[model samples]
Target chain A: PRMKLVLVDHNEFAQAVAGADEAEIIEVIDHHRLSGNLRTKEPIRFINEPVGSTSTIVGIMYRMREAAPDKSTAICLCAGIISDTLHLTSPTTTSTDKEILEWLAGIGGIDSAQFVKDFFAAGSMLREHTPDRALESDRKVFEENGWHISISQIEELGLEEFWKRETELQGALQALLTKHSLHFACLMVTDITRHHSVLLVAGDQRVIDAIDYPQAKEHVYDMAGVVSRKKQLFPYMSHVVTKLDAP
Target chain B: PRMKLVLVDHNEFAQAVAGADEAEIIEVIDHHRLSGNLRTKEPIRFINEPVGSTSTIVGIMYRMREAAPDKSTAICLCAGIISDTLHLTSPTTTSTDKEILEWLAGIGGIDSAQFVKDFFAAGSMLREHTPDRALESDRKVFEENGWHISISQIEELGLEEFWKRETELQGALQALLTKHSLHFACLMVTDITRHHSVLLVAGDQRVIDAIDYPQAKEHVYDMAGVVSRKKQLFPYMSHVVTKLDAP
Candidate 1:
């Protein structure tokens, strides 16, 4: 059947659900960078804003249209905003995110301080998954200057689990480099409670040598207070690749 | 000095002002197809709707924010909506466009019927300008499948002036083809009062032969009721080019 789709949260067809290219995109509400490839037969409703989460934009729309989400729906949206913005601690958080989060939390009857603590403690990817699964859990591939770089992020309550499994995670990242023919592959284990992270990378030597973060060990870097993949690490990696010495 | 910009009406940087590539695009409110090349250092506010005119979107924003344009600004917006949608007669006209136009007219104390009559009578491109000027007055270039095609549109009260200058208009299109190294160049002379148009072409033989519109003469097609370049004629030309036999 021919389908009409309204894309939310993300816009790039690369990150969209399978077979989205064949569907007619009637509307898009996103908060990511435009990938510049999506085309429609005609103009459609598209709204992209620079907020911490797309859930923030959706909440704004509800207010604009004078519509109210059910309590369960409000809870879901609140979770989206909390998870994506790392409980509003991420640098990506805007004033809109803060305002909408409060509104949604009020509607959901959620105490945000308690909610944040419970959310981060609910799942520890480092402890629950095998090294390979943990590394692959939230991975994203980016193309920068002919380099295919894969970055995976895992959010946890503390760095204790990561320290215990660091060796195995490094091996998994190395395996990912070969399996995907990736120029660089890295995993960021972020301690959301502490608002810090440590990066484990395995890839081209020149790219690894370009890391300026204080080294925790041979392949790991202690990145204090860096939690955002979109606003922080991705831009740093893009700059490194852009400034790499000519082959 | 660096500058920040808010693009309205169009999104493609190719159709934007000079040095747009170097400027920071802070926001965009448009009603055209997204060409998708735009990239900002950070996520910016972007709103694109499938309405008849960008003015309609601005009017909507005004109402959404609980603000109103002054009388002169309202009149200008009305003119923009009227011109783009052919006074609510173009196929691109949406319910939003009609509603917004009425609101703007009321704010400006305008009699829409009389305004439409005076607006179309204000300028006749074919009568006031030479063939070259008329053809270049409202031109846009598009690149599709490696073909650089230039399409220009002139809106007039009637086709009488176009008929008087058809030969020179044809000559100008041929000149445009050579000057720009364009694969195809065409001019659409539209009669807004009657909601019809006539297209004149000078291009590669394969592309020219591929046009399926009713031929009015050697190089002109009678495009009855085809008043919109964005919604109607451009799509037809694109289809014609896409179906041309492989060289």
Candidate 2:
């Protein structure tokens, strides 16, 4: 077998990608915040932007390449942004994020407003969610500076229900970490109304220590005003982790 | 059976509500530019603030009532604003609109970013859409100076598809006018990137005449650099119409 080539559950997706045939992992494009595990031997252009959505990142890449977002891609990416940022209602929304989304709508030839309604209706079927389903529904990969991490987001019914199921979600995530051999695993249980987050950590304490959020010491970071994982949380974590990891 | 409380399909579900006993209409609240066909009682609160979204008008009203949006109501209303203004990306977005949306979010206890994402995703699907769905999804309700009208918005789509489908959408809208006995009907197709709109007029010419776009001629009005239908379009139109309709 070819080194048992496989797709790992979360952060390992990037690690499994390392040292593979150059043709195999020729182009790596992701929109999640930077992870400490990413390294490439070949000279490949890496594009990352702090926008509301990774689909938005892809849209920007297409723009830089002077390529328009295709209809399907546009629809998918817009949905990603809508799903990720909650329609730019989050504090994470910047003028740049809005401008890129508008530009995407122009090239993608779709109405952003209409797409938002349709996309939300699809994702907001909360009545059908199990704790495991809720936990795994939205997972993102991160690779940066040789340490890989994966974070999953769960939008619960309310704060009470979120804590009620935190243990179950942690158990599921722990199983996922062991199964995937991820260096760091996290789940951000965001209380949308309260504007707070419970960052459940399951990995090396050193790695968690490296993240070193002023609010992380409680092991339950209250992102009271932290509305965006992309524009706010991810960028802060990336900088802190990099400074700590710097030799 | 009942007095058959007629309403244009473009009006919001709340705007056309009739009294349970008499089938008499209660109030008219709309943000679409003026239409001359509404015949209501002597007293009504015709609130129309054309800023960015009808939700803005409602927000202002809530403020006037000293009713701060609670966390749930704030998220829903904030979502409405973000959805209506396209995350404040619309040409219609104003500083006031942005400020108000932010204010409502703060009051409503939203995680702003997640709320936006959830709201956008809730409303962003537009694939395989018909002319009717395209036109009806974002309709605004209005009753102004005793004249009631509803304006429907179709934002950010391909010009080719819009042109191909506009005639049909217009026809359907005209059918709505007859059904509701509305005196005026307007359809606005907005280009988010270019900040322009193509205005289609039907119903009363006097009402159409009452509409103020000093630059307007026939159906091809130039709403260049215009973004928010609430802020830019309706305010200009209301000023002109109120001037023209002065009794």
Quote each prediction's TM-score: 0.92, 0.37
Q: Which stretches of candidate 2 lie over 4 Å from their true place?
A: A1-24, A30-43, A60-70, A89-94, A106-111, A124-130, A140-150, A156-161, A181-184, A192-195, A203-221, A230-247, B1-247
Candidate 1 — which residues are off by over 4 angstroms?
Answer: A1-6, A18-26, A245-247, B1-5, B22-24, B245-247
Q: What is the lDDT of residue A171 in candidate 2?
A: 79
Tens-digit per-residue lDDT, A152-245, candidate 1: 9999888999999998988899899999899899999898878999999999998999999999999999999999887888888988988885
Write model 2 residue lDDT over B1-247, tens digit each, in one string.
5564433212333344445235643344544433333323122223333466667756765664457766777777787778777788875566767878988987877777787656544432233477667657766545545555667766654345556665676787788678777666677777654657777767767777665554454554556666565656555555555555532
Residue A185 local lDDT, model 2: 75
Clashing pairs in 1: none
TM-scores for chain A over all candidates: 0.92, 0.62
